[model samples]
Target chain A: MTRLDMFIDRMVSQRACLDFAIAETALMGGPVFELGLGNGRTYDHLRDRVTGRPIYVFERAVASNPASTPPEDMTILGDVRETLPQAVGRFGDTASLIHADLGGHNLAKNDEFARLVSPLIAPLLAPGGLMVSSDRMYFDALEQVPLPTGAVEGRCFIYRRPTA
Target chain B: MTRLDMFIDRMVSQRACLDFAIAETALMGGPVFELGLGNGRTYDHLRDRVTGRPIYVFERAVASNPASTPPEDMTILGDVRETLPQAVGRFGDTASLIHADLGGHNLAKNDEFARLVSPLIAPLLAPGGLMVSSDRMYFDALEQVPLPTGAVEGRCFIYRRPTA
Candidate 1:
């Protein structure tokens, strides 16, 4: 498959994961988190799936489609490294679902960025909360989970902050 | 278009209306209703779309795909006129969205079925609730709404149980 095809497959997987997470979190209540808001496609899709939950988005600058951009209070700006810690402080262990789709075109740089943010994300999840992403990742307290049905294997990663 | 094409178009329109209603009700608070569970295709779609809302489904018997059938408590059996009234008694004015796609292939019969159940459904919607259906319908309390974008003009009908 071409690179573009593979990228699109990853996106489709990401969306399926979001849908699955939304359904799983419906009975279990908490807010949602969007780690990257580029174009806001995922954020908009998340809003449609997870009704009635507050969604906090983290972004470095304003580049999302105006139609999809979140309102001021819901959006947290500045470098993720700086803003995410503040978010963790404000919304500690309160997110039922979190989606991290950040970084530029450089794969190596993206890995480094996620590695840097994983720690703050750990304490931001509610018990049994779900975290989905476009990269492969693992946290000591977050147990790895299967990709939702129809999602391509290895394209998207899912984890649950276990209640136990 | 052939009969098959028209049927497919109707199904597509039904799905689009459900998606539209899900987005519309994401901000509103209440459960959802599926008036007909035939084969449970639409019910399954509603489950996927409105993950957070309880979908109480009404049906006469077990004709739907076993995989798609709702749990016993959520499924109402017997004649809708009877079962629906019982449901309305228990869930008075609590539904955020309701989809009625009952009856069989006969168009006139379907219209009769919808007309009979309209009163039963009237008192079941919360303020500003949405109701989507296959037949043209009017309730004194429900104002007709435009079909969601991309839905066939006359194939489906939309309504809102006005808050005012």
Candidate 2:
């Protein structure tokens, strides 16, 4: 396969996992969270799929496509190190779905960042909530769930907080 | 991306979609079908994942690894064009999950076969039953559902029979 095929697979897999998570959490009464805005395509998709729940985006800055940008009230601006902790204080463990695609092209850097953010993200999910990430996350409390069909194994990762 | 990466993506996507469909149809009171059980890898996977549902395998021959072969009572041997229609006579519109990975390496051949079998497969599904195919199938009555995230478009396809 060509590079284009590889890219398509990643995009498709990401969409499949996110859609599954969105549907899985539909009945839960909590908000959704997007860890990075980037071009905000996934965030836009999330907004379209999620009903009766607010979608909050955590980003360093608002540099996404205008059509995909989140409303001011839903955008949490700052370095995630500071902002994520603040979110824990405000929202506690009530996020029904959280999606993160914060990895850089550099694999080593991505791993380090995943390690740093794993704990911060772990505390934000509601029981039975799901976390979808482009990079593998290190979470002690959350169990890594199997990816839904059509998802490349290493291309995407899903974690679920135990209901207990 | 290398050819190996592409192969891995397809395999992963196939697994993900089948798993999703299996979960989606779990509550329905119908059996599962596996079309074209080559090497029986997927047939084995289906047997493991589906609970309380009998799995039926359709094939022209039974040449597969001993570990993966289906029980004789569950295997239907003959050309699919002949056997599939016979199946409809015996079991009409009650398959909860039907998975087909019948395509070969040749794309044109795969598409042609998909067209030929789509109708035969369509009548076997229960309302709300799911059909997961490695190739895009042409079905008049079945609605093509959106592929879940992480699934590369054109690499796999999912069709659902209307619940009504």
TM-score of chain B in each prediction:
0.95, 0.96
What lDDT does each candidate get? 0.81, 0.87
RMSD to truth, every model: 19.4, 15.2
lDDT of 2 at B152: 76
Per-residue lDDT over B41-137 for candidate 1, one digit per residue giving the tens place of the 0 to 100 score: 7877777668677888888777876657899988878878888788777888999999998756577988887777788888888988999998876
Off by over 4 Å in 1: B1-164
DockQ of each: 0.01, 0.02
Chain A TM-score from candidate 1? 0.96
Residue A56 lDDT, candidate 1, scale 0-100: 85
TM-score of chain A of each: 0.96, 0.97
The digit string of per-residue lDDT tens for model 2 on A41-77 reads 7887788778999999999988986767899999999
Docking class of 1: incorrect
Span of ten consecutive residues with least summed lDDT in model 2 chain B? B1-10
Best by TM-score: 2
